[model samples]
Target: MTRSTDSWIQQLSTLMGDFYQLLAKMQYLDLDQGTIDYPPYIDPEKSVDTILATQLGINPEAIQLLQRLPYVAAPARWNHGAGDEEFVLYGCFADFRKDGELEESRDPLYASIDPKDESVGWEDEDGQYMRPWYVPLSRLGNHGVVLILNMKNRHLWVIDQEGGCSDPGLSDVDWNEDLVNKNSLDRYPSRPATEVLRDLMQKFISLEWIPGGIHHGYQHHHYKRLYLAHGWPDNFDSPAFNATRQVWEDEERAQYSAERPFQDVDRLELWTQLPTISSQLARCEAENASPAWHAQFQGGSGRIPYESRKAELLARLPGEQQRRQELLRELEQARRDVVGVSGEVRRRREERLRLDGR
Candidate 1:
C-alpha cells in the first residue's frame, strides 16, 4: 500500500504545527530560538485553533495554517509604523451578516431558492464565485500583505494595502518588487498555501537570522546561533533568500537614513551658551554658599580650613571670568571670520557673473 500525496502533506503540516508549538514555548521562556514567537498575551489553556475560531470565526483550514505559523507580537507597529499591531497568520471570510444580524436575503442562491422555482437563478454576491478568505501572514509596522483565498479556486492570491490583487503566478515577484517601487501595495496570485508558507518562512529566516539592518531586533544574532546549533534547513541557502535579504537591507538603510538628523543645531546652541558659565557659577555660589560647600570642596570635614577653601573658590572666580572674556573674544572673532568668508564668496560669485556676462 502506498501513501497519497495529500497524506504526506497532512503529516508535514502536523510536523509544522509541532515546530511552531515549540517555538511558542521558547518565546514564553523569553528565549530566542526562532524567527518568530507566540504572543505573550495568548492564554496557554486556549489552543491557537480555539482562539482563531472564536476571534476570526474562520474555517478549519485557516485555523490549521495559523497553528502551523503562529501569531507574534511585532516589535514595531505593522504597515506605516503608526500603531501597535500583531503579525499573525489567520484568514477572514465575508460574513452574510449585517449589523450583527445574518441577512437572509444575502444567503447563497442555492440556499435561498426553492427546489421547484425555475425563475430563480444562481447569483454570486461575494465575488470570486465563492466566499473570500483573507489570510494575513506578515506585516511591517502598520502595513500588511494578505493572502486571499476563495472556495471556487485553488490558486492563492496576494492582496496588498491598496486592495490590489496580484496577477496569477507572480505573487512572490510582485511582493519583492513592491518593496522598492513607489506603488508598494500592488499584489498578485502565487502558489498554493503550503508553498506560499514555505517561501515566506524562507524569507523570514533570511531577514530574522541573517545579520542585516532590517532584522527584527538585537536578539537575532542569538537566534542565528541557536539555529546553527539546531541545524538549519537544506533549502536555507538559496539565491532567492539572498536576494530578499539584500532588498530588506537596502530598505532598512533607506528608512534609517530618512529618519536620521542631517544637521544637529543643539551643538551650536551649547557653544553659544559657553560664555555664560562663569556667571552661572557665581550665581550658584551666591545662592548656595555655606560651610557645607566648603566641607564638600575640602573632601569632607577638616581636610582644609573654611577660610582656605573660600579663598580657593574666590581665586578660581577671576580665572573663570578671564576664561569667559577670552571665549567671548573668540566668539566675536569667529563671527567676523564668517562675515569675511561670506563676503569673499559673494565677491567670487559676482566676479563669475561679470565674466559670464562677457
Candidate 2:
C-alpha cells in the first residue's frame, strides 16, 4: 500500500484499540446498565426461564449464558473429508487451558462452570444446538474475553465488545502488530478478530443477543462473564491439562470432521472466504434450472440439459450434506425466529396491558 494509506491505517488501528479499551473500562464500571435496560427475556419454556432466573439471580431477558461455541465458519481445509471451504468456531474457553502447557508461564484462568464430559446437547430435532456463547479467538495481551454470541444461525452473530478469540491456533487470531500493519493497506483487511468480533458484538447488543428471537419476551436471561480467578485450583495439574489437550485434539477433529478425512486447511482467511463463495455457488446451483449450463458450448443453447456426469460430481463433493443442512437449518430458524419474536412481543404487550389494568 502507499505510504499515505499505511499512515491512515495506523491511525485507524490506534483509534479502534483506544475504543476497545474504553469499552472495557465502561463494562468494568457497569455503564451498560445506564446505556441499556436489560429486561427479563421470555424463553420457549417458562420452566426453563424460571430455572435460568433462579440460577442467574436476574430475569432471563437480562442476560444469556452460552455453554459451547460453534463455528461462525469452519476451517478452510484440514486433513478431513470435511470441506476445505468452511470454518467452525467451537469449543469452550478450551485451548486457553492448553494441556496446562502455558500455566507455568502465564497464570491459569478458569471458567465459572466446569467443562463437563457429557455430550453437548442439541436444541432442535435435527440435533442442532443454537446457544449464544462467547468464543475467545486470541489472548491479545490477556485483558478481556473475546466472545461471539452465535444466535442459532439467525441473521448474524452477536459479539461482545470486550470478548475475542484467544486461541493461538486460529488463523483469525493475529498478532496486534500485524493488525496495525494491515490497517496501513488501502483495502486493509480487517483483523479477523476485530472485524468478526465487532460485527457480532453490535448484533448481540442490538438484538438482545438471542438468535431467532426465540427468547425475546422472556423475563430472565443469563450471560457468562470471563473473569480472572484470584487463584488457580490446587488440583489443577499437568495430567489434567494433558487430558484436556487430548480431548481438544480428539474432539475438535471428531466433532467437525467426523465423517470426512482430515486435511490441513486451518488458515483463517482462506477458510472464511472459500466456504462463503462455495455456499453461494451451492445456493445458485440449487436454484438454477439446468445443472449442465456450465458445460454448454459457446454457441450452444442456453437451455442446457441435465448431465449425469455433472450430477455425479456434485454428489461426490465433500461436505455437501453438511452444507445443505446448515443452509436449510438457517432458513428454518429464520422463519421460526420471526414467529417466536412476534409472539413474544405480543405476549409482553399483553402483560404490560394487564399491569396497567387494561
Candidate 3:
C-alpha cells in the first residue's frame, strides 16, 4: 500500500486474471449502495460502448476489434472525463494480446523494425514499434478527457476539455476507500481508471515489448502523461489517423493556448459530421488487411500473427460497394454534362444560320 510507483506496480504484477477482473469493474458501478454513473462527454448521456454501437453505427465486431491492440487500424471509443484535466481514450488492457498470446512471453526475433519496413503505421505520429493505441486510464462516468498511448516511447498524451497544466495520474489510489466524483482531479476513481494505463505501461516495460524488445533499444524509458495541446509527436506505428497537425499548429493552437487552453468541440457540430468521421474511421480499419500489415504484426512484430483476415475483409465489402457507387454517380454526371453541352452548341449554330438567311 506504499505510495511510490514501484510499490503498486509490484502488486499488480501479472497481466492475466486479476487485470481483466479489475479492469472490468472500472467501466461501471462499483457497488449496489452507490448510484450508477455514466460518461458525459459522449452524447447528452450514453456509455462509450453504447454511443459507438448505436450512434456511430459500429457493430459489436468493431467493438471487439477496438479491444485488440496493434488493431487492424487505430481504435477509438467515447467516454466522459474528470473535466478538470481528465479524459479517457476508451480502450482496455485486453489490448496487450496483439492477435493472441499473453503471459509475459513471446520474445520477438527482431526489435526496432524500421518505420519504413512496415506498410501500416500511424503515419508520422509515432516512434519505432510504438503502436498508436487510442486508449488509456482516464476516469469513466465523468466529464471528459482522452489519453492516447504511444507505448513505443512509454508516453501518454491527454486531451481534456480545457487543461494544459501539470498532468495528474490515478496511481496510489485506494479504490475501495476513494469516492470518484466527476469533473475534478482531486476526486479519484473508486475504480482503477488510471491504474489500467500505468499497469499496461509496466507490462510493456517488463516484457520488453517496447521498441527495444529486450535489446539495447528504447526500453529503459518509462511513461509520462502530457497535454495533447498541439498534435501528435514525431512518429507513430500503424497506418492510423495522424490528423494533420499543421492546420492547428499555428493560428488554432495559439488561439487555444492564449484564449481557451483546452481542446474544445461542439457536440452538435460533431454529430452533424458523423458521416464524414465514420467514413474516415472505417477506411482506416479497411486498409489494415494488407499482407504486409499482417506480416508486420504476426510474422515479426512479436505477437501472434493476424488470424481473422477473411472476416475483416468481408466487413469491408460494404465500403467497397459504396466507393463503386460513388464512382458511378460521378461518371453519370459527366455524361449528362457532355450531352447538355453538345445540344447547346447545335442550337447556337442553327440560330446563326437562320440569322444569315443562307
Per-model CA lDDT versus the true structure: 0.40, 0.31, 0.32
lDDT of candidate model 3 versus the reference: 0.32
Model 1 lDDT, residue 145, Cα: 39
Residues 169-192, candidate 3, lDDT per residue (tens digit)? Answer: 534433332423222222223224
TM per candidate comes to: 0.33, 0.18, 0.19
Preferred candidate (TM-score higher): 2 or 3 = 3
- Give me the displacement of residue 324 in model 1, in angstroms: 33
For model 1 the TM-score comes to: 0.33
Candidate 3: where is the Cα deviation over 4 Å?
Answer: 1-143, 169-358
Q: On a 0 to 100 scale, what is the lDDT of residue 94 in model 3?
A: 28
Going through the candidates in the order shown, the clash numbers are: 12, 65, 15
The candidates, ranked best first by TM-score, are 1, 3, 2
Better of 1 and 3 by TM-score: 1
TM-score of 2: 0.18
